[model samples]
Target: MSDAPAPTAETGTVAPPPRPHAVVAVLAFSGVVVSLMQTLVIPIVPELPRLLDAPASDAAWAVTATLLAAAVATPVMGRLGDMYGKRRMLLVSVVLLVAGSVTAALSDTLGPMLVGRVLQGLASGVIPLGISIMRDELPAERLGSATALMGASLGVGGALGLPAAALIADHLDWHALFWISAALGVVAGALVVALVPESRVRTGGRFDLVGGAGMTVGLVCLLLGISKGADWGWSSGTTLGLFAVAAAVLLVWGQWELRIPEPLVDLRSTARRQVLVTNLASIAVGFAMFAMSLVLPQMLQMPAGTGYGLGQSMLTAGLVMAPSGLVMMAVAPLSATVSRTKGPRTTLMIGALIVAAGYGLNIALMSEVWHFVLVSCVIGAGIGFTYGSMPALIMGAVPPSETAAANSFNTLMRSIGTSTASAVAGVVLAQMTTPFGSVVLPSENGFRTVLVLGAGAALLAFAVAAFIPRQRDAGSDRDPEGTVRAASGEGVAEPAAPVTRQG
Candidate 1:
């Protein structure tokens, strides 16, 4: 085995070196908490209708609000981090996570809860920022495995958070969920402060306020239109207006990005085949992953009177999902092995295909509770591989100095996928409902429809994955932000590879 590589400081900085192994582990663990905070509220969804005196449709906003906020914030934060530093951005995000969780825990109404969720969503930016930091700070030898593990955490924490949320909500109160998340955030913040070194890589550019506002407004309107169209009626003025605003703002933003010398988003480079293809696949993977989150909980928690429901309580339902996360944990190393052998492109394609296969089977096999668990296991496995492959693809496509920005852009794409999935699934559930006196309940058909959509998303992801270039080991590629020395003790040389992908 190759000995661990050293972390070289970026030019003009003289920070002390961190213990690479310890820093990597701490940062990776922090990721698990960040991931958990994203979905820890799902198990408590059932209680929201009663506690907030709201309908299920209204209660769903708890999830949708966070998704919207995170989707808007991620890319902007990432780009800003590139202009500033990844470590600095991460610390800011953690503070937001902690504050958001605490606010959510203290909330007494649905409105306040939504406010808290939006705050929590800010931390979602940390995921990509952390991945980018690995390129800047971690040893080259550990980069592959470290990044793969962080990717796995995205699924792992979500999977595990289900059970934790259920247990806390059942035994205590929903407030406890936020409290735990807050604690996790604080711990992550502290660890990051101690273990992670600040980025010496600096791009002296001003923040693009106009570009950020445009992207934010566009994403919010677009996601809101999708998520609420079912409830608001697709033809209603509200829905149509939101959609129009989303399209117009996004189009204008694209044009503005081209004109701006220092854009909030670097559209030119992002539109390159390698980056573009990877981001498209990332969106599909996000869609498929969110489908599981949306459909499974309903299947688990619906009343036993419903023929499709397993009739499990929130706690039990969460427990079932919890075990699935372990499957994803097992998948990371396996994906690493596949990535090394066939390359990241093949590994990602295979992962997406597996997800499609699992969703297709879910359509046929979802009659029983155990079937849900089995299907979740397959989905978890698929997500593990797909998530593991994405960062590697992004890292390979961009210069080391731009790692945080590039990864953040990819993360933004995934968030867009999740937001779209949630919106579409909400629409399906709303339309396919069983009338029960004054109340309407979602029927089995709704979930099945969502699963079919998920299968299509997986297929699309597979197609995108096909376009990513296979990794070559012909020459050593060093971080553009750091100095490089030849193995033979020769003077520092030119970087062996260009950051942009070759057609």
Candidate 2:
């Protein structure tokens, strides 16, 4: 359909081509399994202090450790995947997830539990690595829907994990949760070993330890301040110190990156008008998406007597929200279709506008059970479109050598957006509370305010998407490395055709 595989220097023979469907299926499964880690412990978060015999504040570290670990691991793993092999790093990540789950499963104390969570967090690079794999191995036509399905796994796993975890926490011993995760990790890893192929599209160089260290320290500091600011008191010396250190360290890191020949992230490529603006929009879309996740569950679980609350159980709320994830999956092909015809820039703008409209509708629709379902489905469809298109926009601009690193950086920007959304939503909900007997809870107006903010963020994303430069010439998009594996026929399919010329 495209070109024959290029000969290798050593053997002068082409290896059997990878089965693109098997590769995509395995990688997507691995991504969804790894992403399940994000929401696995959420159902039990309220009882963590009691379960672990620790102060509520200390127990929050269970979640915070994973966030910090993921922030540090994601970009580093991507760089390593590019330097070494994506499939190899993917296996390593799955191993870490297995180990982390076993550790958490065995733990009776906070210390062991925290160790397990950090290991789980370290596995966060799986999704980006998986996307890079799809770009390497899949044919042009299959690539769009494949990448979209892989990206959507991030939300799919979280959405589905909630109800499953709630059901487990409700009936069985909580340790079963980690045990099942470990089992899923095992299945995912074994499937990967059997089905996925290691790509030869490597950046092959000495690891940039200094740059990696700088990035790790800077991101840890920044995320720590943002995540803990509320508990530590926003203006406290500790919080301020962390923020100041983050700002200074990141500034130095940016300057250092530009000077290094093989920096952790190529800021020049990142600064491309398309890459930069798409990343900006990614932040807003991520914020808007996570806002819905936070608001919907709480609103659904709140007491019915509160006038607007649905008075559903955690399991019920999760079930109510589950269809959104299914909707996201259902729309993957549709997203690829639109992206194929209109260009990813246009698709992203359409997605942002849809998300904005969904939020606007949510403001008026908050009173009914079916309303939550309908509103979530609308927003989920938008997310499906945006997530599918962002990677296309990114890969089109970056060379093959930088694919994993570039995609990982983009993923990190989304993480920052979600984290910031959590903080901002927490502040608003805290500030606008109503008394419910002995308990003080967020008022209906607080949720409406957050919805308004989400709509505004989505609008901001649409504005940013509007400014991304139009698609580049097909050949111009490739050959950034002066050569590509796709160009050489190095045992893998060419980029499912240049992203621009696909449809």
Q: How many clashes in each candidate?
A: 0, 2
Q: Which residue pairs clash within candidate 2? A: 139-496, 140-496
Q: Give the winner by lDDT.
A: 2
Quote the positional error of residue 63 for candidate 2 in Å: 1.0
Write one digit per residue (lDDT tens) for candidate 2, span 73-106: 9999998998889999999999999999999999
lDDT of 1 at 293: 86
Residue-level lDDT tens digits of model 1 in 175-249: 888998898888899989888887655554788899989999998998888778877889999999999999999
Candidate achieving the largest TM-score: 2
